[model samples]
Target: MIRHLGLCLLLLAAFWVTPTAKAATVCTATSTPMIFPQAGPTQVDSNAVVTVTCNTFGLSLLATARVRMCLNLDGGSVAPAQIVPRRMQNSFGDPLNFQLYSNPAHTVIWGGSAAPGVPAAVQIDLEYGVPVLGGAGTATTTIYGRVPAQSGLAAGTFTNSFAAANAVLTYRYSEALLATPPWPTSCLAGGNGGASTGFPFTASAPVASRCTISTATDLDFGNVPGAIATNRDQTSAVTFTCTGRTAWNVGLDNGIHAAGTTRRMRLGTSANYVRYELYRDAGHSQRWGTTAGTDTASGTGSGGAQTVTVQGRVPAGQMVPAGTYADTVTVTITY
Candidate 1:
């Protein structure tokens, strides 16, 4: 009985001594890939810089990891897509094409030593230390690119993806942002400065003068003889005063007269003495002289003020007519 108890105890001790293996499972965490600035259409001006950011989170890996970016043109999944340099000159003065590489790559290089066809894609490898409990970790990187010339290809929508493969990793991509070229220097200069000189203006005095008739004296006929009587000649003067300066070219016309008729009757015979004449006195060059009658006497003054005279004469006749006749004159001036 003691021996049986001993064997049972020994069997129980052996069972306790033998270690039970516990199954171990590989640890892994997945995160969604993300791109910054969203993903859509993109445009870049000449000498512009474009930035692309990729972020990875919730990765459970304690070892090194890598992130890569690739571009597909016209749905072409090839390693590299063709990029045609537009409005830009290449190293050899030829058009440039697109290229790709494994190293962190970027697109759109500006006036840089690197040729236009350089790779535009990039890959970033992150070697994170052992992951802490709860599978919490994150990785981020940025890629820069540039535009080459004043103008480039018509911008369009480009689809890109950020993928974290080794071990389940979650990643996300943000919208794409476009960069514009610098402002034009010539446009700024035109606003503040110009080509011509703007200064020193002058004005001159007036050139011509004007005048109007202020007053006109009434006509006075001297005494007249009765029929079968004697007749006498008489003279009278109508004076005008000038108010303004000298007129350039002065002229005169018969402005005033008996209503409806342009004719005037004289004291002598109807045909001989019907018209009148005007003259200037030698002593007073500005003063005018009298003539046969008062209807036709007219004159002009150019420089200064002057006097005007009118004269009339009646001839003797067998039967002297008895009546009164009169007319007026007008004057005009021009520059």
Candidate 2:
């Protein structure tokens, strides 16, 4: 009886030491479908949302896993290509040995193919570890890109798919949100916001004043008969009337010439035939007068009318010419 009891105890010990078969669970994940916009300018704005869930299946804390995202051009009908793969991040913003790849300029087309000239689609793969403690895990990530016309993509439709997997974990897939980009415009008066004023606002050309020689008289020229003379003097009165009531400055041009002739003669010369000897009294003696023997004269005039008399003289001639000799004088006015 003692031997039999020992045998039963040995059998119980063996049964207690035996290990039981454990169930296997694979890590899995699901992603929402992604869509793209059709006809648009080179630069189009768009956004997409993806939801990923992971299950550790009550694994040990030391157990690690990986997640990947891929883009399938030409619709889900074709195989997905890997793009940027990022490691999952912890509660902190630090990366968990992960990376992400994306092309902001991405567009889709029909015919179960990516836009004819469109670049290869982008893909992202993420890898992470399941916490030792059993709990539900979830992450929602946003993906954005722009569509350009150069990619041979016209106004059309597109689709995207996502998948996740682990060695011993299960995953569920969810639909992603695809939205059309917003368009912005300018709302000013003109296309250039009233920047360019079409018409020019400029004044007309100034009207030149019309001047005429009114009166001229010889001063202090005592009668002469022979060649060579001295101390001769004369005076002349010149009157000017402005059609428009505008102030003007009357000055000598020093370009005195014979009538209808281009040749210029110097002031106080025989060819000039007129010399400004000295300025006598005038209404405004202080302002209207010649500078010593200088031929030029300067003075202001009233708007309606004004007159100035210039005092001058000629040298005695040894023999006075018989014929009438004429000299030209020029008067210029500026307002």
Candidate 3:
């Protein structure tokens, strides 16, 4: 019995003296980029996911670990400025403003402690050495992105890159036995194995060439009840809205019934016709014609309502029956 007791004591002593591997919670993370839908003159929105993976690496007698992560995503270059956040350079740099948020409503902006903005927080529980080989766990959080409504932005792909050292990933962890209460309160707390590293991600969207003619006022010369009328001058307006910095030409097509470049307002289906013309200028020197470059009003869009005046004139010395004379002229906008 005494020999057996000595052997047991030796075995227990050897086990206690043996060297042990360090216990730690090693963590890594990846981010999915936020991609907005096609953005135009209106605000666009999108969302992405950040996946955090925590692994109980090495030999740890710890049964479990609780991790706290803080994501500071604002300030510096990764900001949501209305004009500088997203830029698509064509001939010149077109600036479009955007922002990042933590909530789906987009009311809460996503920023880090450095931003002094509310940083995204993620907490997870991981089991250490429970699976025999090792144990790992993953947690996911969402990031919302929004590009506020703006105009005059050049057409191209607009992107905001959070790459290189622009973005940072950080975490804090504490190990314990099963059903443990004490854990790290904040990841931003100083010291105690807190680690920080950078991760890369992007927020991108595209703007295409687009234009619209919102309204067109009629050119009314008023009633002319006489044998022949004096020279009548009238004007109307055409409103065009297009993407900023876009070049466009507004052309006027001849009426439904016309001879050569002459535009005339026919009286019903009779042989009577009133000679009239549409000009790009008030002096009636530049005739508004179907020609795209020539005889057309050319201008660059400011991404807002642009008014084009159409000067119309009816020459004197025309005899017509007492009735309403009208002509429909088509307005064509070429960009």
In terms of lDDT, the best-performing candidate is 3
Note the Cα lDDT for every prediction shown. 0.28, 0.33, 0.71
Taking all chains together, the TM-score of candidate 1 against the true structure is 0.25
Q: What is the per-residue lDDT of model 2 for residues 24-99, given as tens digits with 9 covering 90 to 100?
A: 2232333333333332223344455445454434444333333332332221211223222212211222221111
Which candidate do you rate higher for lDDT, 1 or 3? 3
Regions of model 1 farther than 4 Å from truth: 1-199, 227-231, 241-263, 266-305, 328-335
Q: How would you encode candidate 1's per-residue C-alpha lDDT over 1-335 as one tens digit per residue?
A: 45544444444444444222111212122222221221112322211112223333333433222222222112012123223331211122222122211223443321111245542322222222223221222433222322322112121222222222211121222111121112212311211111211111111111123334544454444545564244343444444433223333333443243233322345433332232222233222232222223323344432234455444333345453565444555543343
Q: TM-score per candidate, in order?
A: 0.25, 0.24, 0.80
lDDT of 1 at 310: 42
Candidate 3 residues 193-305, lDDT tens each? 56776657877888776779998999888988886558999999999887877789999999897888789898888888888999999899999987778889998877778
Model 3 residue 128 lDDT score: 34
lDDT over C-alpha atoms for residue 331 of model 1: 43
Model 2, position 203, has a per-residue lDDT of: 10
Cα deviation at 101, candidate 1, in Å, is 79
Query: Which should have the higher lDDT, number 1 or number 2?
Result: 2
lDDT, candidate 1, equals: 0.28
